[model samples]
Target: MRTALRRRLLPAAAVFLLAALPACSSSSSDSGSGSGSDAAKATESGWSFTDDLGKTVKLDKAPTRIAGVNDQIVPLMNYGLEPVASWGYSSIKDDARFDDLDTSGVKQVGTAYGEIDLEELAAQRPDVIVSEVYPTDEKGTIDESQPDYGFKDLDQQKQIEAIAPVITIKLGGDGADVVERTTEFAEALGADAKTVAEAKERYETASAALTKAAKDNPVTVTSLYADTDGVSVAKAEDDPALNLYAGLGVKFFEPKPKGYYWGNYSWENAGQIGGDMWLLQQAGYDTAQLKKQPTVADDAALAAGQVHPWVSAALDYVSQADYMEQLAGWITDTKPLDD
Candidate 1:
């Protein structure tokens, strides 16, 4: 069974629109019937996409009035294709995913925990909606019942689809893959090549610098999430953020129990898994409260002020680059407490 913490940790939205959708509806299915001529015409006209679901979403022209989920909006903006509207797990101001973004112009269709404003979203009249898709099978079958990135709940999904074609890229891959796929989607939507190229260059530079810094400093890092229930250490192989950090040369503390993305621990046992630095997942919780947790306070890294913000869902290139720079700076600025 997937842990509740897994769902809570991700920025992706949940499905809550089952009552509104037909029992046997295929609204979000990839089996839309389109003629061969239509496919040829789409290729000639300029915009077409075979999403992760194998569904072909076509446009007469590149979409200018775009709508996206919170995590997706930032990347679209970075590629110079800002969405006209967006919905997210929190208000624009509160979501760290969009800290560097200027979302003043983009209309907020909904905020926090999959609550979407159908009327407002309809008002946007978007040509297409973009979001991240999670694959359910080895053959790339996506779970279409739920919208990704906290855009809409199950009941509101079909309603949102009625307003626009929902295009999605697969989620849960390496950070580099996420950047490449997101850029490809943006490019298809008419994002400026120069802007995308610049973002990619920035990411590459930051990643290289981070890798080099880790090599020189060699600090052991651990990623964790703490709540009232307990604390959990994230597995590097299972989490994209942790994997990215590991790829950049930071060594992570391995948990005793294997095969799961996160290992649950009581507050008292959190310090057993030692590290020179700790990355605390900061989503859906108060950082101040987290700092005050007995487990966190007891950890050597946390007590020594070696704790850093770990935005697990920062999939976009610009955010990833910024995070890389932050980690690199931390590595260079502080000496290992264990040393």
Candidate 2:
């Protein structure tokens, strides 16, 4: 298996960073100005900034049009930017909440690993395109034999740049922490601080509740994904979804060998394992079907209700604040979901 170490860079990580990585470069597309005083103007809404890739990108002035592929759709919606096109065809049901935002209507792009219907995307004339690209074994071929979310390189970001200014968010890493990244998107969109502040408050409130719960009754959380082998458990140390539970002070099942790649294990043997909460991070399958395996078993989580499915709309950005709220709500019974 290829090493999974590099996939941890989260989009929010950029907030804590200003230095560019060797593989990435600031966009040279927008050469507006770079002076201290000019920097202020450049950051203003509608202005463009050169990204680390050197691409001159014009931030959406009235950014009414957008295109998001894969999980990128969630962050776009989290920042209140509805896309004109989405690439998750089979997972469209997974995005009902986001669809509700722009009830006007949107075009369904394509999603063969986010291959996308470039013609359709181009037709939309989006001001921004958000995508995650991982290095594949061949230039155009995507290796399905891999485990890490398929984001192996920044080439996809570069490709999107040809369409529009693209901002690549890192998928792995403790940096950015979700809320920070959401804030950055909000900042990019010139979204009102009220939205950002409310998200922050929700996260803080949720995190506090989870912390209290953890002190008295810490729970272990695990995120399982379907792999070619069988049921594959992504180590908590690197999986962002599981990382939330860890941050909330809950005990997470850390595998003996931890890395970004999915660890293989039989579903029939899942019952031998124990966790206070079994979070089903269903990328594209029914949890009921997964539970039927011999290794897995019916439980209180599914019965009395401890099994929490990651709500796509609820934790849209997985922003730090969003993480806090998600962890809090998932663990605490203090308030209703609307609360």
Q: Pick the candidate with the highest TM-score.
A: 1
RMSD in Å for all candidates = 5.8, 9.6
**Across residues 1-339, which tens digit of lDDT does each residue of candidate 1 receive?**
134345434443443332332111113335542323332133555566656555676666666788877777888887767688997767888887677677777999878656777667767767788766554433434566666645546656666776777776666546566666676677777778788778889989999999999999888887777777666787776665566778778788887755457777776776577778877777534457766866666656767888787674456677788889998998876567764
TM-score (C-alpha, index-matched) for candidate 1:
0.82
Give the alpha carbon lDDT tens digit for every residue of 1-339 in model 2. Answer: 213322322111111111221122234545532322232223345565332223445553434566666466655555555567776534465554455455244676664443455556666776666544333321323343532232223554344455655654434333225435434544555555676667566666766776787766555665555433455555655545455656668666554443344555655455544455556654533566655654554643444456665433323333445445556666654211110
Model 1 segments more than 4 A misplaced: 1-42, 135-153, 284-296
User: Which stretches of candidate 2 lie above 4 Å from their native place?
Assistant: 1-46, 50-64, 89-100, 103-105, 133-160, 226-228, 257-261, 267-272, 284-291, 298-306, 311-339
